[model samples]
Target: MTRVLLIGALLAAVFWVFSIVDCALQPPIRHRGVSKPVWIIIVVVFPVVGGILWFAVGRARASALAARRAPDDDPEFLDRLGSTSDQDERIRRLEEELALLDAEDDDPRWRRPVPPPAASQSTAPGDPADKPADRPGDGDDDARDQRGAAGA
Candidate 1:
């Protein structure tokens, strides 16, 4: 009995407070029976019944609901005429990109990075490139030689 009474009292207080806040935040015309100031007075005067009525009877229509919702949830905006071609174009572009990515995956340039040099193949003494080549011996010296020959 005590618990029930306490719960009911808490609920009444919450509803009263939320009603006051909601009434204050809402636009004037949205209140069904009275203006914003009157609604605030009513909610404070008759907390439970007034709060319940505020939600039940004073609720806004779908269009008015849009004023409070995110743009995505705005019914009018979502229902507005749109071109299917735009979606199709986006999908086509994405598919083309994905196909290119697939082709890249097959190409060696995009292949999984060469595995790190095998543990057994120690780095050559004083090699400038740290842990070059996925495996040992694939090193800076060979690359430098090729460049040097090209330069000559």
Candidate 2:
């Protein structure tokens, strides 16, 4: 008999804890008669009785829970969304932009041209013509050669 009483008390305590957690976790709108905090207080203060009351009276009905909807899923909210014409206009603008891009791809003027080097610029460093000693009118040896050519 004492063991039976202890087991019953243990079950009640577990039920009380479960009820308090359930009540506290519930959203305010899901509470039936009173606010969520009040429900939590009721469950906390009365322990086993509070937990039973919370499950029986305070919790929202299954139908009410089932009736809740997210904003995107709600019919009234979807109806308030802008008309198809606005979406069509935006799509048309996007198509126009894509057409412009396609036209640019086919147009010669839109192509980037690789420019030829200017005549005044020297060749790359490894070339004999690019060496300072080989270049005309550059250093003392070139000036001497020019004077010798003039004298000849």
Say which candidate scores most in lDDT.
2
Which one is best on TM-score? 2
Worst 10 residues of 1 by lDDT: 143-152
**Residue 70 lDDT in model 1?**
77
Q: Candidate 2, residues 1-152: lDDT per residue as tens digits?
A: 99999999999999998998889887888899988888888999999889989988999876767676899899998899878999899999999999998877967788899798878866787875666653444543443566334323
Candidate 2 lDDT for residue 80: 94
* Candidate 2 local distance difference test against the native: 0.82
- Per-residue CA lDDT of model 1 for 1-152, tens digit only, reads 99999999999999899999998988776777667888888889999998988888775655755356776787777777366887799889999999997777666776678777767645678866555543324643344555223323
What does candidate 1 score on TM? Answer: 0.40
lDDT of each: 0.76, 0.82
**Cα-based TM-score, every candidate:** 0.40, 0.44
